[model samples]
Target chain A: MSRSTPLREVHETLGATLTDFAGWLMPLRYGSESAEHNAVRTAAGLFDLSHMGEIFVTGPQAGEALDHALVGNLSELVPGRARYTMICATGGGVLDDLIVYRLGSEEFLVVANASNYERVAAELTARGEGFQAEVDDRSDQYALIAVQGPRSQEILSSLTDADLAGLKYYAGLPGTVAGVQALIARTGYTGEDGFELFVAAADAVSLWQELAKAGDGYGLRPAGLSARDTLRLEAGMPLYGNELNAGLTPFDAGLGRVVRFDKPGDFVGRAALAPLKDVPPRRRLTGLVARGRRVPRHGYPVVLLTDGTVVGEVTSGAPSQSLGKPIAMAYVDTNLSEGLAVDIRGSHEPVDVVDLPFYRRSK
Target chain B: MSSIPEELSYTKEHEWVAGLDDGLTVTVGITAYAADSLGDVVYVQLPEVGGTIEAGDAVGEVESTKSVSDIYAPVTGEVVEVNQTVVDDPSLVNSDPYGEGWLFRVRIEGTPEDLLTSEEYVTVTSSEA
Candidate 1:
C-alpha cells in the first residue's frame, strides 16, 4: 500500500491521475502535461513536493557531522542558505543527491529523495554516532509546496510578507504565509525561479488553497511529476535514479565540482574520490537532441552512427516542450562526440551532441 | 468515464472502427480512453497508404510525452488512405480522437473478428479502469 500526502484529498478533488511513486501515492498529472510544462515556462505552476523527505539534524556538532557524512563543506555553509550535495558509499558511488539547508548555527535540514530517505536517515544517524548531533526523519510531519516559474515571485508576494525580493537563490527563512508558519525557501528543481514553502502537514490544504487563489490571474496550474520531469530534463538537472547511481561517482556524471576534496576531515567517499579527481572518466555525461520526432528514452543504447557500435546509454529523456524536439542526457564515451544515434527500439534515430543544458532560462 | 459511441465497434486494444456498414471501407482510430491514458500525443507514425496489413499487425506507432503505444491494424486489409492532418499535428489524437483524429481508412479483406459492441466495450474499459 502506498502512503498518501496531506494534500491527497485536494488533488483528488481536482481530478488528478494518481500513481504510486516511491511508495507514495502522487499525482501524475491533472490534465494535459504539455500545458502544465508550458505554464511553468511562461507563467507559473504549483507543485506538491511533500513526498520529499526532510531529515533534521541538530546539536552543536551538526555541521561537523554532515561534513564527515557527505561530500561538500557544509560547516562553512552560511546560516539560512542551502547547498546541493550528495552522500556516497565508501567506494565513491553515490548513495543519493541531497540539498542541505542551514537553518541556524546548530540546526540543518537535509532534504532527500523519497525512495532513499529512510536509508539516508539511518546512514546519517550511524555516521553521527561519535559526534554530538542528532538525526531525526521528520518527513511525515511536513508538507512542501513549490510555486515555480517567471511570475513565481509576484504570486508568492501576495500571500506572504517574507521579503521575497531579498531572499536570494538557495536561501531560506522562517515566515508566515497565509497566516500559516512556514520555512520559505527560494529553491526549486525546475529551471525557473521559485519558492518552496515547508509547513506543518495540518496546514497544507489551506495554504495550497490560498496560494492557488493568489495565483488565479497569473495562470498557475497544478503541475504533476510528469511536467516536473520534462522541466528538469530541459534544465539539464540530474535525477537520482537516472543520472546518479550506486555504480557511478560524481566525476563520472561530470559533476566533479560538487565534491570538495579541499574540505577538512575525511568524508565517506573521500579516499575513493580523491584518486579519481584528476583522472579523466571513461564515460562523461553528455546531452543529445533527436534529429527525428522519436524520443530517445532511458536505458536506450547510444551507438555510433558509422558502425552501430554502442558507445553509451541514455539516463533520462523526454519530448522537450521548450526545444520542441526530443532531448536526452546520456553518459557517452569521453573520446567520442559526433556521429551519435540512439537506438530507439529497433531503429537508430540520429542525434546531435549538444551542450549539457538543452535549455537555459534567460535572465 | 470516457465516451464510447454506441454506433461504433471497438477492439480490446481501445481502437474504434467506423463506417463498417458503408461498403467495405472502414475508418479506425484510438478511443478517448486510450488517448487520455497517453497524456499528450507528440508524434504519430501512420501506416503507408496502399500498404497491405493484417489484423493485429503492428503497423504504426503513437508516441506520447511519457510513453509509446503501437497502433495495430484492426482489420486485414489494404490501407486506402491515411489522415495527413493528424500526421502533421499529432495533438489531434488527444483533442479529437474520434473525429479528425481518425488514423487510417482500410478496405477490409475479411470481416473483423473479436470486435466488441458498445455495451461490451464499456464493460472492458470499466474493468480496466
Candidate 2:
C-alpha cells in the first residue's frame, strides 16, 4: 500500500493522474506534461513536494553531528542558508542526496528523499549518539510546496512580503505567506529562481489555493512529477535511484566538489573517498542527444558505433521540450567522445555527445 | 467513457477492427482507451507493408514518455498498407486514434478469433478502470 499526501484530495479534484512514487501516491500530471514543462520555463509552476522527508536535528551539537554523518561540513553553513550535500556509507557509497538548512544556531533541517528518509533518520540518530544533538523524523508533519521558474519571484511577491529581493540563492527565511506561517526557502531543483515553502501538513491545501489564485494572472500551472522530472533532467540534476545509489560515490558521479576533505572531523566516507578523489572513475557521466526521433529510455545501452561494444548505460532520458530533441544522461568510458550511439530498442541510433546541462536559464 | 464505435469489433488487447464485416480487408488501430492510458505518443513504428504476420504477433511499437507498448496484429494476414502519416507524426494516435491513427491494413488470411463487440469492450474497459 502506498501512502497518500495531504494534498491528495486537492490533486484528484484537479483531475491529476496519480502514480505511486517512492511508496507515496503522488500526482504524475494534471494535463499535458509538455505544457506544464513550458509553463515552468516561461512563467511559474506550483509543485506538491510533500513526499520529501523533513528530518530535524536540534541541540548544541547538531552541526557537529551532521558533519560526521554526511559528506559536507554542516557546521560551516551559516544560519538562513542551505547546502546541497549527501550522506554516504562507510565504504564511500552514496546513501542519499540532501538539502540541509541552517534554521538557527542550534537547529538544522535536513531534507531527504522520500525513499531513504527512514534510513537517514535512523542513521542520524545512531551517528549522533555521543553528541548532544537529537534527530527526529517529521516527514508526516510537514508539507512542502515549491513555486519554480523564471517568473517565480514575481508570482510569490504577490502573496508574501518577505524580503524576496534580499534572500540570496540557497537562503531561507521564516515568514508569513498569504497570512500563514511558513519557512520560505529560496531554493529549487529546476535550476530556476524559485522558493520552497515548508508549511504544516494541515495548512497545505489553503496555502496551495492561495498561491494558485495569486499566480493565475502569471500563467502559473500545477506541474506534476512528469514535468518536474524533465525539468531536472534538462538541468543536469542527479536523482537518487538513477544517478546516485549505494554502489556509486560522489566522485564516480562527477560531483566530487561536494566532498569536504578539509573539514575538521572524520566523516563516514572520508577515508574511502579521500583516496579515490585523485583516481578518475572508469566511466564518466555525460549527456546524449538523439539524432533520430526515437526517445532513448532508461537501462538502454550506450555503445560505440564503430564496433557495437556496450560501453555504458543511460541513467535518465526524455524528449526535451526545450531542446526540441531527445536528450539523455549516460555513463560512458572515460574520455570516450567519438563514435557514440545509443542502442535504442534493437536498432543502434546515432547520438551526439554534449555537455551535462542540456538547458540553462539566462541569469 | 471512451468512444466504442458500434460498427467496429474490439479486441481485449485494446485494438479495434474495422471492415471486419467486409470479410476481406480490416483496419487495425489502438483504441482511444489505450492511447489515453499511454499519455502522449511520441513515436510509432509500423510494420512493413506486404509482410506476413500471424495473429497475436507483436508487429510494431508505440513509444510514449512514460512507457512503450507493442502494437499486436489481431488476425493472421499480410500487411497491405501502413499508415505513413502516423509514422511521421505520432500525435495522431492521441488526436484521431480511430481515423488517421490507424496502424495498418491487412489482407485477411484467416478468421479472427476471440474478438469482442463494442459493448463487450466497454465492459472490459469499465471493469479495469
Candidate 3:
C-alpha cells in the first residue's frame, strides 16, 4: 500500500494529480504547472512537506556534538535559528546534507531528506552516543508545511499572532500558527521569501484548512512536488539525491563556504577538509543553457566540443522559472577550462561555466 | 482535472495526432495528460523536416527536469514541418498542449492502423491515473 501524507485528502479535494515519490504518495500538480510555478514567483503557494524527515538531538552535549558531526560552523547559532550543513564521512565524502536548528542551548533539531531519514538517524545516533546527547527520530511526530512566495508573510501573518516581520531569512521562532503551536522557520527550498512551519501531525489537517481560507486573496495555491522540484532547480538549489550523494563532498558540490575548518573542535571529517581545500574537485557542478528548447537531462552524456571527449553528465535541468530559458546543471571535470561547450545529446552548444545561485531575487 | 479534447485522436504513449484538411499530414504533439505527467517540458528534440520515420519508431524526444520521454511517431511518414515556436518555448507544450504546442507535422506515406479514436482514447485515458 502507498503511504499517504496528512494533507493527501486536502490535495485530492483540490484536484491535484498524485504520484508515489520516495515511497510516499505526493501531489505532482494541483493546477497548471505554469500557473502554479508562477504563483510561487509572483504570489504565494503552500506545500505539504510532511514527507520530509525531522530529527531531534537533545541533551547536555547536543551543541558540541553537532559541531563535530557536520561541516558547517554551528557555535554561533542561537535559539530559533537554523543552519544548512553537510555531514561528511571519514574520507570527506558527503553522508547527507541537512538543516540544523538550534532550538535551545542543549537542544537541536535536524531536518534531513526523506529517503535518508533512517540513515541520517542511524549516523546521528552512532556519532552522538559518545557524547551526552540523545538522538531521537521525531519524523513521525511532526509534519512540515511550506508557505512560499513573495506575499507569504502577508498571508501567513493572518493565521498567527507572532511577529512575522521579525523572522529574518534562515531565522525561526517557536510560535502558534492557526491556533496550533509550530516552529515557523523563514527558510525554504524554493527560491522565494517564505516560511516553513513544523506542527504536530494531528494538528496538520486543521492548520492546512485555516491557512487555505486565509490565503485565498493572495493568489495562494497549493503546490506539489513537481512545482517544488522545478522551483528549486530554477533557483539552482541542490537536491540531496540529485546534486548531492555519498560520492560527493561539500567542497566538490560547490559548498566550500559552509565547511568550517577554523573551528576549535575536530569534526568527523575535519582532518580531510584541509587537503581538499586547495585541490580542485574531480567534477564541478555547473549550469548550462541549450540552444533552442532541447535541454539536456540527468545522466545525458555531456562532451567537450573541441575533442568530442565525454567530459561530464547532466544532473538536473528544466525551463528556468526566473530566467525564462532552458537551463541545466552538470558535473564536469574540475580541471576543464572555465569556458567550454556541452554535448547535449549529439549536438554541441556553448555553456557559461560560472558561479552558482544562478537565480537571484530583486532585493 | 485536465481534459483531452474529443476532436483529436490520442496514442497510449501520450502523443495526440490531429488530421488536417490540407493533406494526409497530421499535426502531432503530447496530450495535456502527457504534459502533466512530465511536469514542465524544458526541451524538445524535434524530427528534422523531410526526415522519414516508421510507425512506432523514435521520431524525437521531450525532456523535463526529472523525466526523459521518447516522442513516438504515430504513423510512418516524412516529417514535413516542425513547430519552431514550441522549439523556442517548450513550456508552451505544458500550457497549451493541444493548440499552440503541436510538435510537428508528418506527411503520411501510409494509413495508420490500430489508432485509438477520440472516444476510444477517452476511455483509455479515463481508466489511467
Candidate 4:
C-alpha cells in the first residue's frame, strides 16, 4: 500500500490527480500538466517533495563520516551550504544520488531519493560505524515544499524574512516562514531559481496554505510530479530510477564531477572510480530530440539509423512542453552521439543528438 | 466521469462507434473517458485509408506525454477515411474526442454486434474509475 503525505487532504481539496510514486500516493497533477510546466517557466509552481528521505548525521565527525561514505568531499562543505553527491557501492555502482546539507559543524542532513532512503540510511550507519557520529533516518519528521521559477523569490519573500535575495544558490538557513519554523534552502531540481522549505510534518498544510495565498498574485500554482518530471527533463536533471541506478556508475551517466576523488579520505567506490576518471565508458548518456511527434519512451532501444544495430536504450523521455517537441535521455555509444533513432514501439523514429540540457533559465 | 454519447456504440477497448444505424459505414474514435485518462494527446497514428482491419486488431496508436495506448478496430472493415486534422492537431482528442476528433471512418464488413451501448459504457467507465 502506498503511503500518503501530510498534505494529502490539501491536495485532494485542490482536485489533484494522485498517483503512486515511490510507495507514496502523491499528486501527479493539479490539472493540465502543460500549464503547470509553463507556469514554472514563466512564473512559479509549488511542489510537495515530502517523499524525499532525510537522514541526519550528528556528532563531531559527521562531515568526515559522509566524506568516507559518499563520493563527495562533504567535510569541505561549510555550514548553510549543500553539495550534490552520490553514494556508491565499494565496486562503484551508485546506490543513490544525494544532496548533503551541512547544517552545522556536527550536523549534516543527507536528502536522498525516496526509493533508496532505507538502503542509504543503512549504508551510512554501516559506513560510519567507527566515526563519532549518530546516523538517524528522520524523513518522516519533515515535509519538504519547493517554489520554483522566475517569480519564486517574489512569492517566497512575501512569507519569510530570511534574506531571500542574499541566500546564495545551494545554501540554506533556518528561519520562520509563515509563523512556522523551516529550513529554507536555495536548492531545486527544476532548472529555475527556487527555494526548498523543510518544515515539520505537522506544519505542512498551514505553510502550504499560507504560501498559496501569498503567491496567488505571483501565479504560483501547485505543481505535481508530471510537471516536475517535464521541468527536470527540460533542465536535463536525472531522476533516480531513470538516470541514476544501482547498475550504473556516475561516470557512465556523464556526471563524473560529482565524484570527488581528491577528497582526504578513502571513500566507498574511491578505488573503483579513481581509475575511471580519465577513461571514457563504452556508452555515454546523451540527449535526443525527435524530429516527429512520436515520443521516445523509457526502455525503448536506440539504434543506428543506417544499420539498425541496437546501440543503447532510452532512460527517461517525455514530450517537452517548452521545446514543443519530444525529448529523451539515452545512453548511446560514446564514440558516436549522432544519427540515432529510437525504436518507438516498432517504428524507428529519427532523433537528433543534442546537448544534455534542452533548456536553460536566464540568469 | 466522462460523457458517453447515447447515440454511439462502445467497445471494451474504450472506442466509440457511430453511424452503425447506417449498417454500411461508421465512425470510430476513443471514448472521452480514455482520452481524459491519457492526458494530453501529443500524437495520433491512424490506420491508412483503405486498409483492411479485423475487429479487435490494433489499428493505430495514441501517444501522450506520459504514456501510449493502441487504438483498436471496433469492427472488421476497410478504413474509408482518416482524420488528417486530428493527426495534425492531436490535442483535439482531448478537447473534442467524439466530434471533430473522430479517428477514422470504416466501412462495415458485417453486422455490428458484441459492442456495448452508451449506458453499458458508462457503467464500465464508472466501475473502473
TM-scores of chain A across candidates: 0.99, 0.99, 0.95, 0.99
| Count of clashing pairs, candidate 1 | 0
lDDT per residue for candidate 2 within A294-345, as digits (tens), equals 8888899999998899999999998888898889999899979879999987
What is the Å distance of residue A88 in model 1 from its true position?
Answer: 0.3
Question: Which regions of candidate 4 fall more than 4 Å away from where they truly are?
Answer: none
Q: Global lDDT of each model? A: 0.94, 0.92, 0.84, 0.93
Per-residue lDDT for B1-129 in model 2, tens only? 678889988888898999988678999999999987887788899889989988888999998777789888888899999999999888899889999999999999868888899999999999988
Off by over 4 Å in 1: none
State candidate 2's TM-score: 0.97
Task: List runs of model 2 lying over 4 Å from the truth.
Answer: none
Model 4 pairs in collision: none
lDDT tens per residue, model 3, A1-363: 677888888888988889888788998888667678889999999899998889999998888778888888776788889999988887888888889889888888899988888888898888776789999999989889999999999999998889899888998889999899999999998899999999999999999988888889999999888789879887889988788878887888989888988887888887887788988788888877755555666777777767777888888877666766667788988777544666666677766665566676676
Chain A agreement with the truth for model 1, given as TM-score: 0.99
Ranking by TM-score: 1, 4, 2, 3
Writing each residue's lDDT as its tens digit, candidate 4 over A201-230 gives 999999999999988998999999999999
Whichever of 1 and 3 has more lDDT, that candidate is: 1
**Tens digits of per-residue lDDT for model 3, B1-129:** 567787787788888889844569899999887887787777788999999988898888888755779999988889999999998888899989998999999899867876777788777778885
Question: DockQ, in order, for the candidates?
Answer: 0.92, 0.61, 0.51, 0.73
Judged by lDDT, which candidate is best? 1
Query: Pairing residues by index, what is the TM-score of model 3?
Result: 0.91
